[model samples]
Target: MLHYAYGAVKKSMEAYVTRTGSNLLEVPLPFAVKSNDEIVSEFRKALERGKSNGNRVRLNVIDHVTSMPCVVIPVKELIQICREEWVDHVFVDAAHSIGCTDVDMKEIGADFYTSNLHKWFFYPPSIAS
Candidate 1:
């Protein structure tokens, strides 16, 4: 199950990089243990680096990490980060957040989103969409 979820994320990242010609793709730490301020600081750094290097930077944020309970990124901050010029794309991995939390994709404004229903909603192992 973990393999498939990661595979989907990998493919999506590849697609974004290919489409936008982005050389820098930033992914948050696993389990997302960092505080909101820390995450935003890192994202800003990545954007600054991308701007200086003349590359588009993409941010991949996991709404909720599977390994750590209560480790999540706030939607408001995510939206703010997405609005930055250096951020070409924002991908949200909501695999652990789909059914467990209230998520409105339209409000979040992510360029891409993926969730595994089977993990929480009990749909099917291969039915992630």
Candidate 2:
């Protein structure tokens, strides 16, 4: 499976990966990126790297919006690329997506998508959907 490099992922998701004992392949998102397309291109390279090693990328854990610097990731484009590359699963952590952006799950096409309502919708703490 693949995940965003440091400063781009939530701590809980990292901890969950550690607990599950899955090997993580980190894909860096340039802090000074010129465009969202740059990030998408990096993802494509990672997928290609995995394929070059004769392995299909099993999953891609995408952040709909990164937490650190609060950049909105191109989740829809990334998911579409994953589909084209035949990635088995795409899990979108949309923790900051709701209310902050227009989200349509059907169009996004991620296998798993989650958002914390409390993060934007003003729900009580720990409430998410």
Candidate 3:
């Protein structure tokens, strides 16, 4: 699995791996990564490292926009990279992007996506889409 550092869904993913006994590799996103290209580069490097170690990246959990650091990730570009790298599945966490950004699921094209409407759409805290 390829996960972003400080990704919102990390806790849930960690629990899943703990139960399944799967190894996880976190792609670090340093503070210097302030642009879309920089963030994508980090993930790309992580994928290459995994491949070099004879490990296939089966799943990638990415963010559309990070909540803490508030970086606008290039979701489509990262998805394309995952495709080229032969990653089996991609789960995009768009919790902070639903109403604030232009998010066309068909265009982004990930295996799965999740967003909390309350964060940007003014719905109840439990609301999600």
Indicate which candidate wins on lDDT.
Answer: 3
Clashing pairs in 3: none
lDDT of 3 by residue, 27-127 (tens): 87777576777777888888888677587877898888777767778889999999998999998888878887898999999999989988777889998
Cα lDDT tens digits, model 1, 1-103, are 1112355566776786789776534544435345777656665665566667564445644454443445556655755665856465666777777877788
Could you give candidate 2's per-residue lDDT for residues 9-115 as a string of tens digits?
A: 54655676699775467776677767988888888887887677577677788878776667788888889899988989999888878988899999999999988
Each model's TM-score?
Answer: 0.66, 0.83, 0.87
Q: Score candidate 2 by lDDT.
A: 0.78
lDDT of each: 0.60, 0.78, 0.80
Error of 1 at 59 (Å): 6.1
lDDT of 3 at 78: 91
Angstrom error of the Cα, residue 52, model 3: value is 3.6
Relative to the true structure, candidate 1 has a C-alpha RMSD (angstroms) of: 4.8
Q: What is the C-alpha RMSD of each candidate to the true structure, in Å?
A: 4.8, 2.7, 2.1
Candidate 2: which pairs clash?
none
Task: State which candidate, 1 or 3, has the greater lDDT.
Answer: 3
- Of 2 and 3, the candidate ahead on TM-score is 3
Worst 10 residues of 1 by lDDT: 1-10
Q: Candidate 3: list runs displaced more than 4 Å.
A: 1-8
Q: Let me know the TM-score candidate 3 reaches against the reference structure.
A: 0.87
